[model samples]
Target chain A: NAGVTQTPKFRILKIGQSMTLQCTQDMNHNYMYWYRQDPGMGLKLIYYSVGAGITDKGEVPNGYNVSRSTTEDFPLRLELAAPSQTSVYFCASSSQGGQSPLHFGNGTRLTVT
Target chain B: GQQVMQIPQYQHVQEGEDFTTYCNSSTTLSNIQWYKQRPGGHPVFLIQLVKSGEVKKQKRLTFQFGEAKKNSSLHITATQTTDVGTYFCAGDVTGNQFYFGTGTSLTVIP
Candidate 1:
């Protein structure tokens, strides 16, 4: 059913460049999140949205921004990319805030030179 | 800030052997969820535990939640090659974010 979809499976950016990571879900979930995973490390939360027109900062929101303009879309934006920002980014959605299982997208691998 | 930690970063077990991974949270959690990520794949939900001192089993796998709601564990009996993956424990605190543990990478050898 295409639970969650992330665009641009892979991308490369030079320092100071900007790009957007697109995420969309078809399950009509209320909670969406953005996370980054470094090699051999756990997923770190970047930004999250409880519902349309509502967003909040997560554990690791630096150098990233997010917007939830509709129920089906939550996009992450990277401005002035840095080497430290190079990592695999994942998008997830859940039916509720807690106690619900999350549906995740395949993820986008980004490299910043 | 809440944090979840997992032990035994890597584990290798022969087929038919048992495997276990532990997770601890620095703060009390409202609920704990387990996920498995296969090689080159996104995390997939496995189970969720909410009650204190709760124990649940799914076929060959067993899951337990600490009495204080700050720790959890997952044990697998008679492991197989299909069990190879990185297991992660994610805790939900204050009803908002899901903080994930470092994860335990398990390998089942034939």
Candidate 2:
């Protein structure tokens, strides 16, 4: 079973460009999250969804947006890429309410120039 | 917003030596989890502590939660090269968001 799948393992974007980071989980988890990890830093929450049609802002959700239209998908969108936004992005899912262990995707290495 | 912080931002130890990382939360936590991330890899869940003053062990690794439920620690009995990675602590405050600590990078010298 594919726990969590993230598309565009690596991507490079010019400043002001926009892109979407796709995330899907086959585990039928109810909770999904988007996080970014900078060099030598911990994961910073960006956006999260508890269930379909429900989403919320996380600790670091300024430059990004998220939508959960279906139970299996939660995608993160970067409206305008900036150098500071260049980092490794990860998608994660949990079966229970943030109380369960999180299953994370391989991650997407994004670079903005 | 609840904050979780880790100490010893970076550590280097010789093989066979013990290592530990501490996690402290700005407020009381409902629970806390530990994760390990290898170089250029995603974070993987290690263990979770829910009860105050709880302790759990995974072979060579030991995890503990403070009595106040606001702090935790992970201790590795004997470090190995395979243990080289960054350890992070995530705390659940409101049961909705789990704030992650800054993380402690550990390097083992063989």
Candidate 3:
């Protein structure tokens, strides 16, 4: 079974461009999160959803938006990309918040020039 | 805001040597989880420590949680090439948010 799946493994965008990074999980998890990792740095949370129709901003939520329309899908939207947004974006899911281990996707490498 | 810091940002060890990475949090954590990410790969769950002064082992890897629940450690014995990766410790603090440590990048030489 595919635990967590992310589309467009790699992409390059010009400044001010907009795009959506799609993430889906088949494990029936209720909590999902979006994180970005820069070189030699830890993963920084961008957005998270407790369940369907519920979402919250994270530490680095600026310039990004997220929507949780279904239990299995949590998509991260970059409205106007900037050079600072060039990083590896990871999607993760857990059965519960703060108590379960997170299952992560391979991640999408985004480069904004 | 809660923060987790890891020491020795990068470590290089011989294949048969032992390596340890320490993680400290500014605030108490409900639980701490460890993950390992290989080069050009995603982060994978290694282990989770919940109780105070807890220690768990996975083969050659040993994980420990401090008594105050604000610190943790990951020790790898007799490291091999397969042990090369970036190790991260994520702390679950109040408000259900995770604060990830800067991570320790390990390079095991053959």
Clashes of 1: 0
Candidate 3, residues B45-92, lDDT tens digits: the string is: 999999999999999999999999999999999999999999999999
Q: Which predicted model would earn the best DockQ?
A: 1
Candidate 1 local lDDT, B30-62, one digit each (tens)? 999999999899999999999999999999999
Error of 3 at A12 (Å): 0.6
lDDT digits (tens) for residues A38-87 of candidate 1: 99899999999999999999999999999999999999999999999999
lDDT of 1 at B86: 98
Q: For all the models shown, what interface RMSD does each have? A: 0.8, 0.8, 1.2
Where model 1 places Cα greater than 4 Å from the true spot, the runs are none
Measured against the true chain A, the candidates' chain A TM-scores are 0.99, 0.98, 0.99
Clashing pairs in 1: none
- TM for every model, in the order presented, reads 0.99, 0.99, 0.99
Listed per prediction, chain B TM-scores read: 0.98, 0.98, 0.97
Docking class of 1: high
Interface DockQ of candidate 2: 0.85
